[model samples]
Each structure stands twice: as structure tokens, then as C-alpha cells.
Target: MQHFPTGQAEHKRHRRLARRNANGIYNWIMTNDVFYRKVLAHLKHDYSKLEQHARELEQANVALEQDNVDLRNALLAKEQQTAELQREIEAQTKASGACTRRWPARRNQVWSDGWNRLTNELAEAEATKYREKSKTRRRKIKALKNRVRTAVATSNSFEQWLLFVEQEKQDVETLLARYKKKLQAQNRIMTEARVLARELRRSAESTIFNSSTTVNSWCSTFERGIAHVIVAGELFSTSPATSDGSSCLRSDSELIYGMSTLEGLETARRGSPFSRSS
Candidate 1:
């Protein structure tokens, strides 16, 4: 309890209060500075993240633009190809129409010529066939004419041959009739001669036994008599031998006279004018 001055105490009390207030304000300022430093660090991290996102967006936009440029180039090339195809189609259509208009007359002319040629060939072939047929028919007709001529000539020759054969047959028949009559006459003469020869032989045999003449003399006389008789008969009759040898037999004188007469007849025949003329 020390007693002091009022002005000093009062001054000391005011200074103490002011110093407490100042210390409280300084603690508040320190708290606020720490909070501001933490906030600044968070803001700095957000700003760096925003800058990286912006760089990625820019790279994606650039790639999209390049893809759009490639698509536009492909579209333009496709449009050019479509236009060229359309032009080619129109040119082909026009060319086909022009060929169709120009070809019909030429085609018809070719067809008509071919048809005419075929008809001419057929006509020529038919004419050839007709000519061949006519030639064959003419040959057949000529051969038939030749056969007819040959047949007619052969028939004429056959008729002539038949006439000749008939003439020969008639001549043969006449000759056969004459030969038959002659044969009958000769047969009768032969029969009479045989009978006469048998009688004469018997008579000569008896005469030979009784007569005084020799056998040789008798044979000579008999031969002379027979010769005279044959000569006389030939001069007088158609036959050389007498029909009856016995009847024709004569005496020696008579035989000699007959022989002389035959000689005279032969001489007269030679001297006759009719014999010389024949």
C-alpha cells in the first residue's frame, strides 16, 4: 500500500491494457498468414491440371481436322469416277442406236443373195438329173431297137432255112422211091439168077460125066457163053444180067452170033450222030 501519484497510475494502467491487445492482434495475423499459404498451394495445383487438359484437347482437335481433310479428298475422287461412268454409258447407247439404223438393209440383201444362189444350185442339179435320166432312157430304147432288128433278121433266116430243109426232104423222098423200085427189080433178078445158076450147075455136072470133052475145054466154053450172054443182055435190056440164066443159054453157034451182033450194035452206037452230040 504504498501511496503513488494518480497520473502515473493511470498511465501505467492504460499501457498494460494496450500491450495485451497488441499481443492478441499479432496471434490473429499469424493464423491468417498460415491459412493463406495453404490456399495458394491448392490453387497452384488446380491451375497446372487445367493447363494439361487444355493441351490434350488441342492435340485431339488437330487430329480431327486432318481426318476431315482426307474424307473430303476421297469424296471428290468418287464424284469424278461417277461422272465418267455416266458419260461412257450415254456414248454406248448412241453408238448402238446408229448401228441398228444402218445394218437392216445390208442384212436383208445378203439373205436374198444367199437364197437365190441356193435356188440356182437346186435348179442346176435338177437339170443334170433330168439329162442323165433322158440319156439312160435313150440308151434303153436304142438297145431295144437293136434287139428287135436282130430278132427280125433271125426270123427271116429261120424261114429261109426251113424252105431249104423242105426242098432237101422232097428230093430225098423222090430218090428213096426210085431206089426202092430199083432194089425190088434187082432182088427179083438176083432170085432168078440164083435158080438158073443152080440148074446150070446140075446140067454141067451131068454133061461133064457123059461128054468126051476135057474139063479145061468145057470150062472155057462155059465162060465164053456166059460172057456173050451178059454182053447181049446189057445191049438189049435195062439190067446187065438176064432174069433167067437158063433161058438166056444158047448153043455155041448161037452164042457166037449173039456176040457178033453185040459188037455190031456197039459199032453203030459209036458211029451214030445222036451219040456224038450227047
Candidate 2:
């Protein structure tokens, strides 16, 4: 590490003694322009970060909306499937007309007492066997209907599927609502960020305007002091070493100290010559 001389830092502090004005902060900022620029950079970084986060929230909101759409589409498909299932249940509950078309009856049988007076005994026996088989098939069909009715009454009822679909839809709605709430919150944050950024910009603008005004005022004051010094046109000199080994300034034999010393250097320059030539 580089080390400063014992008195070098003190001398530098002495050099900067008159740098500050009545407005302490503005003078310090004018002297150190780096601090002002650092403040600007911080504001810019904060605004950029806020904008980036707002964009991310917008993208997330879009994705969530798309997911909600997909959920709605799925719900539509489920509703269509449920409708088809209901139609199938109704069709199964009632016998189809296709079977009637398959078992076409003879028109002449009604004239002969509806197939009761058959000439061939073998034909009659075949009809009887057919009737028995049809009875057994009808009994099986009734048993299947009973099973289907039991299934409808039990946990496998249509209401179960409808309830499940409703539950899924409700869940999707809930998720969508939750996402909407998050999106709204993000929007609010983004809005607040925008407001904050605007406020920061205004604050920076005000600070710059105030600093410039202060700098102009300081310049005017310095000009007046320089004009007065020029009008005096006398050379000022430092005094002899005092008892404390510190030099006292004797401008026209006046002992000045602290804040007033910087403000009144012209009074000393008018009375004494700092350097004399033979």
C-alpha cells in the first residue's frame, strides 16, 4: 500500500478548506463529480431492473393464460365425451330397431291365426325351439340391463364422472384465479416501479437543477471575490511562525480564522505587499 507523507494529507485538507460554500452538499458534489455520476448510474440500474422484472411478469402472465386456455379445451373435450357416454347409456337401455328389421314377420301369418295353424309338425317344433331360444336371450338381456342399472346406481354412475369433471374444472378455475391474482399483483408492482422510476427521474432532474443553480451562485460569488482582489492589487503574505509552530496569516495585520478567513482575503491584499523587490 502507498503511504502518504505525515503532513501531505493535512496540506491537501488545507487546500480544500475554501472549496465548500454555504451550501455544503452542493459544493461537495461540485468538487467530486464522481459521486454525482454514481448516483445517476444507480438510478439507471434500478429502472432497468424494474423494466426487466416487468417483462418477466408479462411473459409469465401469458403462459398462465395459455395454460388456462388448454384447461378450458380439456374441459370441453370431457363434456363432449360425457355427452357421448350418456347417449350410449340411453341407447343401451332401449332395444334398437335394428333387431326388429332382422326378425321380419310373414304377412300371411296373420290371416292364418298368427302362425298357430302350422301344417308341418317339424316346422312347428322348430318354431317352438326358436321361441325358447329367444326367451333365454331375452332373459340374458334383462340380466345385462339389471347389471347396467346396478352400475348406474353404484359408484359407477354418470353423476360420478360428471362430478369428477366438475371438480377438475373447478380446480382449473381455481388455478386460473390464483394466476390472475399473481398477475394482478405483479402488475401493481410494475405500476409502482414505473411510478418510482418517474419519481427518481424527477428527483434526479431536481437535484441537477438545484446543483447547477448552486454552482452558478458560487461562480458569481467567486467572480465578485476575484474582482475585489484585482481591485485591491496588493500582494498578500503569510505571517511568521506562531508559538504553536503553525503559521498565522497577516494580511494587513488582521488575524482571521475559520470560515470568515476564506470569505475575506481581499482585505489583507489591499494593505501589505507579500513580496518586496530592491
Candidate 3:
């Protein structure tokens, strides 16, 4: 049982060992690649969703801004209507005052006395000659009374219209105030949504960047590992060419260097973003 393997058999064994190690590393690298790919896909999906949400928020803000503009326009129109109504009210008030002044209570007696004197003068004339004149005078007095009554009716109507207009103005003011409050609330909501979307987008981008960087670092490490394995295999295959121990020493040193490089990559990976949290 103290028999040693032949040189050819020993080389075959080394080849098998190297192949097995390479296979294991390849499988490990594949697993890590799949994992990182899944992570990247997930991050991309999350970022896409956040971007969609941000777009929706932007649309909502646009709608809100349009609504604010419409509200402001309506408010301006209402103000204009109110001012016009005020002017009409003032004009009506002046007309009503003028109508009142035209028929003053203190002048009522004077008007009656004048009418009586004119009637007495008409009666003193010949009856046949003054009949048509009396009829014309009566018609004139009736027309004057109608005019006074029309003025009074107009004044009353103006008062009613003024009251209605005042009520409408108050209602418009109330509505304007409500619109202002609603517009303010909408603006606040829009601002908050924008801020939330911005923060979410920033966070998503940062996370994706960090994840991408980590994946790249891991990929580089795996690539270096595969390269080192290939070089090591080449050295082992060539080692049989020389009958000196230096070949084995060189292989050992290359392995040590590869291990040290792997250790450094592992250290770097541990210092990555995700690892920092852990």
C-alpha cells in the first residue's frame, strides 16, 4: 500500500482537481450573477414604479394649477361683477333720491294752491270757450300725476333690485372665499406630493447606483478569480515539462497571490453599501 501514483496518473489527478475547482467556482459565480441580476431587475422595477408615481403626481399638480387658474379667473370676474353692481346700486340710489326730491312734501301745498287758482281763472271765463281748455288742463294734470307715480314705482323697483344685487354680491364674496381656501389646500397638497415624489426618486436612484456598483465590484472579483484559475491550470499543466522543484514553488506562489487577491476582493465587497448596513 506504500505505492505512489505514476507521474501520468498524478498529472491526471491534478487535472481533475483543477477542473472540479473551476466547476465549483463557475457555479458559484453563476449563482451570484443570477442573484445580482434579480436584484438589479427588482431595483429597476421599483424605480420604474416610482417614476410612474411621480408622473402621476406631476399630472395631478398640473390639474391643480389649472384649477387654481380657473378659480382666480372666476374670482376676478366676480369682483368685476360686484363692482359693476355697486355702480348700478349707486346710480339707482341717486335716481331714487332725485325722484324723492322732485316730489317734496313741503311743495305739495304750493302745487295744490296753484292748481286751484288756475281752475278758478278757467271758471271765470265763458263756459263754452273754457271747456276745451279745462279738458286740456285736466289731461295735463293727469299726465303729471302719472309721471310722478311712474317715478315712485321706478324708485321702489330700484330699491328691490339693489337689495337683490347686494345679496348676490354677498353670495359671490362667500363663494370667492371658499375658492381661495380650496386653491390653497390644493397648492399645499401639490407641493407635498412633489416633495414626496422627489425624495422617492432620489432614494431609488441612490439605491440603484449603489446596487450597480456592488454588482460591478462582485463581477470584477469573479472575473479575476476565473482568470487566476485559468492561469493556475496552465501552470499545473506545464509543470511536468521541467524536472526542477522551482516549478512547484512557482505554482504555490501563484496560488498564494491568487488567494491574497481574492481576500482583497472579499474585503472590498464587505466594505460595500449593503455590507455596511449589515
Best by TM-score: 1
lDDT per prediction?
0.59, 0.54, 0.63
* Per-model TM against the reference: 0.34, 0.26, 0.28
Which pairs of residues collide in model 3? Answer: none
For residues 38-149, what per-residue lDDT tens digits would candidate 2 score against the true structure?
5557667877887898899889889889989998999999999999988987786554555455435434446555445555676888999999999999999999999988
> Candidate 1: misplaced stretches above 4 Å?
1-84, 124-278
lDDT score of residue 239 within candidate 3: 35
Q: For candidate 1, what is the lDDT?
A: 0.59
Q: Write the per-residue lDDT of candidate 3 for residues 162-202, one digit (tens) a residue.
A: 98788767766765665465445445534443443344344
Please report the TM-score between candidate 2 and the true structure: 0.26
RMSD of each: 20.0, 85.9, 90.1
- lDDT by residue (54-97, candidate 1, tens digit) is 78778777877777787778778777877887788778778778
**C-alpha positional error of residue 276 in candidate 3 after TM-score superposition, expressed in Å:** 23
Clashes of each: 0, 0, 0
